[model samples]
Target: MLYRRFARPLLFRLDAERAHELAVSGLSRGWRALPGVPKEDPLLAQDLMGCHFPNPVGLAAGFDKYARAVAAWPRLGFGFAEIGTVTWRPQPGNPRPRVFRLPDDRALINRLGFNNHGAGRTAGRLARHRRRGHLGRVPLGINLGKSKRTPPEEAPSDYAESLKHLWPYADYVVVNVSSPNTPGLRDLQEESELAGILDALAAVNRARAEAAGSAPLPLLVKLAPDLEPAQLDAIVDLALARDLAGLIISNTTIAREDLASPASLAAEAGGLSGGPLRERSTQMLARARRRAGDGLVLIGVGGVFTADDAWAKIAAGASLVQVYTGFVYGGPGTARRIADGLAEYVHRAGLASISAAVGTAAEGGA
Candidate 1:
């Protein structure tokens, strides 16, 4: 109520990127003063990719692209934080006015193009956080992207280099081959290409584990929502074949269909996210879950604003749920509210645990 009635109106008035910067700055400096959410219900706890998450809600990649507010996520009630879509090298990203808001539709279009401070720098910052004991309790995953200047054929090596640099700091690593803003990035999602990338990262993960005498870093892939069913099926097959950790289910969509926002805003050239993406993303999640079965872990993202939306995804096969644009519009209480709502829904449904609800709707058992 406070966000919609007060904070949102003010933030919405500013330019989108500028408003984001202000929010990030404020959270980074004052996160400790923020109120904590209710104690996590054990029913909501999840053991995914060998890491124990206190809840199922996580902050998706792209929000904390540079790891500036690692500690703030748990305070704000996220079960985990996936920072970065960081590349092997830093780039300025798309030109100004790259991010725009469509308040009428409760969506955003961003072509920000992985504008982080590069892998090496990001690792340094995370190291500092670790040294200060400010890394928070929830697991931290790093979403790795290929450098823009790196050629398509070399994407495997490009991604491998980043994993090597960031391996120590990440609880898990996400291979992002689906950002629509980067030219030819999505091409890496092809069966053979994606296999190569995953293969390379798998080798790196194994070497790191052997050297450290620890478990290999769990590796997952993020896919684009605009893919055909055949494309998605192939990727799922590759994930299983390579023995990868799981899939992130989706990135933002390039499709602009059925939006309530004006054509001018919808016509913008970038990936579209938030409320308009809910149905499509959920459908994809259900399909992936059906294809991957019980073996693969899936994190459903796109257009998740409320507990009901999160529940829809969970029932459709998402083991975990993530939010990006929804967090932008829903304010600080969003995660807590959604987590609490999910726990209440689980209780009402007479389920043993939140995991019992996964895929029930998709499997026709709901």
Candidate 2:
């Protein structure tokens, strides 16, 4: 009640990226205050790709570019955390003023091109956290992207390099071929190119699993919401046929249609995320679910800002869900509120477990 009525409105007054950094810093300090927040009813824990999630709400990548907040998240009540869209080399990303607020649309647009302290620095941070035993029970997934200077044809090598170096620290690895801010990266989602990338990583993963005497890290493909239906169908078919672990139903979109932002702001060059993305992302989830069927897992993400939004994704076919903008907008209590709300919805709907709701509505749409 306090966040929705008070904090959110005040935070919305600031420029989006600055507001985001301020919130992350404040939440990192106040995470311990969460235990005293109301506990939502317990929902069944989930197992995805041989890993257990305490619950289904996950912090999407981009929130923690350098894996700086891993130890603070579990206390914030998220079931999992994914950090980075980190490149092989550290780059400043796009120019300042690259991130913009679309408050009237409750959305954000950013041309912040894959900026980070690079994969090596990120790995060192995680290694420090691991040695100190600081990463909480929540699992971690690392999102890998190609360096800006790497040519499109060399993407496989770029991603492979990331996987080779960062694999040991990540519970899962996401091939982020879809962020629109990166030039030519989305083109890699084309079947021939994507398969080559996935196939190369799969080989490395298989060997790594054998060498470690355990299962390979679950590999998920992050996609763009801007894809056409035929494109989406082909990608799902590829995932199923190739036996990839799963799909993250979307990344930030390039489209600006239907936004409530002023015409000038709407014309900004970048990807859009937050409230305006909810319905479109859910539609993509539904379409992908129909094509992928029960054979592949889906992690729904895009514009989720409330528990109802989260529930809508699960019904559409996401076995798990993630949030970036929602957390930015909804504040620290967002995850707890969504998880608690979904748990109530599950009980009221008479579903035995949250998994039972996955794609229940999608079957009809399918």
Candidate 3:
């Protein structure tokens, strides 16, 4: 309520990218020193991918690309926080005015092009958090992307390099082959290409686990929202084949759909995220759940801005839920608000916990 009336109106006035920069700047500074919020509802807590998430809501990748605010996430009520879309080498991303706000539709279109400090710098920041004992308060996830200069064929090595550098700091890692802004980046989602990258990552993960005498670190794949049913199924197969931790069911969508924003802004060339994305992403999650069954964990993303939206994802089979564009519009209280609503849902449904509600509405699972 406060954020919408104050912070959001003020932010909407600033240039979109500038506002996001200011938000990250705010988080980076004052967070490390404060004690975070304690756990909320026990009903919302569940163990998945070897980590016990205090709740199912997580800050999605692309929000904290630099991993600068490691201590702030749990303090703000996120169950986990994913940083980066960081590459092996830093790049400026596509030129300015790359993010557009569609206030009418409550959506955003961004072609930020995976802009971030390279893995080396990100790892350094996470190391500082680790030294301060701020790490592992909530599970930390590092999302990897290819350097803009890397050819598609070399994507495997590219992702592996970033993962290798950031490995020590992350409880889990996401291989993001789904962003549409980077030329040919989505091509990496092809079965043959995806399989190679997953294979390479698994080999590296296994080696690290052996050295530490622990199980392999959980590794997940984030998908594009526009994929066909067959394509989504194929990726599920590859994830299982490679022994991945789970799948993040989706990145933003290229499809415009029936958006209420102006055609000029709606037609903007980038991935569309927020309200316009809810239905399609939920459908994809349900479909992927049917294909993977009990074998794979599915973390749902895309267009989730409220508890109703998050509940839809969980009912459709997401073991957990993540939000990106929604956070930009909804404010810092987003995760806590969503978790609070979810607790009501579990109680009303007579379920013991949120885990019991997972997949209760999927096509076949129900």
Candidate 4:
């Protein structure tokens, strides 16, 4: 109520990227003072990809690309937070005015181009958080991306370098070949290219596990929502063949149809996210779930704004769901509200646990 009625209106007045930076900086500086969300119910708890999530709702990757706010997530009520789309090399992203809001559509269009302080810097930050025990109570996943200057053929090595640098600090790593901002980044989603990258990361993961005497870190790929059915199936096949941990069902969509926002806003040249993406993302998730069955973990993202949306994703086959645009529009209380509502939904549906709800709708449809 406070965020929507008061904070949002005020924040909305600022430039989109500026408001984001301010919010993140404020949270990073004063997170300890913010009240934590209520304890999650056991029904909402989930064990996926070897990490125990206290709740299924998490903050998606783009919001904290630098991992600067690592400790603020759990306190803000998110079950987990995936940080970074950090590249192997530091690069200034696309020019300013890269982020735009579609308030009328409750959406966002951004072409920030994986702008971050780089993988090594992000790893160093996470290292400091680890030493201080400040990473909050939830799992932390690092989303890895190729350097903008790295050519398509060199993507595997680029991504591998990032994994090597950040391995120790990440609970899991998301291979991001899905963002629409970077030139030819989405092209890495092709079967041969994606398989090579996964293979490289898997080798590094094994070596790390042997050296550290810990379990091999989980590796999941984040896919673009724009993929064709055959492309998605091929990716799933490669994931299974390579023994990957899971997939983040989507990054953002390049499509521009069915938006309620102004024509000018819809004409922006970046991935579109929010209410308009809900149906497409959910449908893709359902398809992937049916193909992958119970063998893979799927984290649904895109257009999730409420418990009902999150629940729909879970039922479609996402063991976990993430929110980005929704968090921006809904504010700090969003995760808690969604988690609480999901627990109630589970009870009302007479499901034993959140896992019981996974892929139920997809299975019924099949």
User: Which candidate should be chosen as best, given lDDT against the real structure?
Assistant: 1
Query: Which model is ahead, 3 or 4, in terms of TM-score?
Result: 4
RMSD of each: 1.5, 2.0, 1.6, 1.2
Model 2 scores a C-alpha lDDT of: 0.84
Please give the lDDT score for candidate 1: 0.91
Compared with the true structure, what per-residue lDDT tens digits does model 3 show for residues 129-194?
899888978898899999999998899999889878888888999999899999998889899999
Task: List TM-scores for all candidates, in order.
Answer: 0.98, 0.94, 0.97, 0.98
lDDT of each: 0.91, 0.84, 0.89, 0.91
Candidate 4: C-alpha lDDT: 0.91
Model 1 pairs in collision? none
lDDT of 2 by residue, 1-366 (tens): 787789888877877678777877776566665574234335646888887777889899899887877767776778888999988878889887788878788788889999888888888888888997766477799999989999988888878877877888888889999998888999999999999899888888888889999889888899999899899899999989988888998898888878778999989999998888788888999988988787888999988988899999999999989998888767777788788888889999998789899998896552
- The residue pairs found clashing in candidate 2 are none
Query: Residue 248 in candidate 1 has what lDDT?
Result: 93
Model 3 residue 232 lDDT?
A: 90
Candidate 2 Cα outliers beyond 4 Å, as residue runs: 4-10, 27-42, 364-366
Task: Kindly report which residue stretches of model 3 are placed more than 4 angstroms away from their true locations once superposed.
Answer: 32-35, 364-366
lDDT of 1 by residue, 136-181 (tens): 5899989999999999999999999998889999998999999999
lDDT of 4 at 72: 86
- How accurate locally is residue 238 in candidate 2, as Cα lDDT from 0 to 100? 93
Candidate 2 vs candidate 4: the lDDT winner is: 4
Query: How many pairs of residues collide in model 4?
Result: 0
**Worst 10-residue stretch by lDDT in candidate 3?**
32-41
lDDT string, candidate 4, 95-201, tens digits: 99999999888899999998998888888988899888876489899999999999999888899999889999888899999999999989999999898998888
Error of 4 at 221 (Å): 0.6
**Considering lDDT, where higher is better, how would the candidates rank from best to worst?**
1, 4, 3, 2
